[model samples]
Target: MANSAPASVWRNPIHFLAFGLGSGAVPKAPGTFGTLAAVPFFLLLQNLSDVQYAIMLVVTSLVGIYLCGKTSKDLGVHDHSGIVWDEFVGYWITMWMAPAGWFYIVLGFVLFRLFDILKPWPISWIDKNVHGGFGIMLDDILAGLMSFVVLQALVRFVF
Candidate 1:
């Protein structure tokens, strides 16, 4: 079963981050809301060069492993519903090198959320087989990559 938001999410800095800065604390569809919260951060990152953006992705992803694992362990839950850092990172990944416009942003959002929610093929496999914080983040990472491909393609051809 899915785990609910814990008090530690507000009290502990790590939990606060893992929960996507409290965006995950929402009672329903926290991942969606958490991804919504990520939009502003993505806007901030849009100005970065590709290399710098890649570095930021790496840093955030690495930190997410620790934040998610520690928070899940503390809460005694595996991939708690409120842990939405993965969603934030995933959304960011989807928007990598995307065109600067509301259309691209919204498209990236939809694509990322679709892949994340659907969890096709390897994503579903990894989600089932992996464990701990890395596991929690891996599935979303794949989803982001998949969405990135689609979004980039749209930029190249459709848009």
Candidate 2:
């Protein structure tokens, strides 16, 4: 930025992701846009077998923690809204309960965004204070958990 605090924070990856690979940097709700951008990745991850899905989810979360942490450190920001890799992995976590379907995907997306945005109780708690790798990944992980539980309930009762 022209008068942003640190010079280092304005680097390439931070700049790119800060715009959400240019999406967040748009003139609208960048965070929402960033989350929206994670959809296709979710679809790709959704195609795998249950065992593969589980393995991928674990790996994605683990990798996301490190990646988010490193990126935050580099950007001189903590859990910057621009970083949406956590969003990607988190959405994948939400889809873990069932196979890919537009209804489930859309609902899961909405729920995850709600938990992420409204930050109900614990999500709000984490967003307000935590600052680091786990901090960055924790809220989204929780959102995914919330999505998973709700989706599972819906599947068990309705379907």
For each candidate in turn, the TM-score is 0.98, 0.81
* Model 2 Cα shift for residue 26 (angstroms): 3.1
Q: When superposed on Cα atoms, how far off is each prediction in RMSD?
A: 0.8, 3.6
Stretches of model 1 off by over 4 angstroms after superposition: none
Which residue window of length 10 is worst by lDDT in model 1? 1-10
lDDT per residue for candidate 1 within 1-159, as digits (tens), equals: 364688888999999999999999998999999999999999999999999999999999999999999998998889999999999999999999998999988999999999999999999999999999999999999999999999988888887
Say which candidate scores most in TM-score: 1
Clashing pairs in 2: 17-20, 19-24, 19-25
| Position 157, candidate 2: lDDT | 93
Residue-level lDDT of model 2, residues 10-126, one tens digit each, is 466544543345554444555577678878777777778889989998887787777678877876677665666677767777778674588888888887788777878798898
Show where candidate 2 strays beyond 4 Å. 1-22
Model 2 global lDDT (CA atoms, 0 to 1) = 0.71
Clashes of 2: 3
Which residue pairs in candidate 1 collide? Answer: none
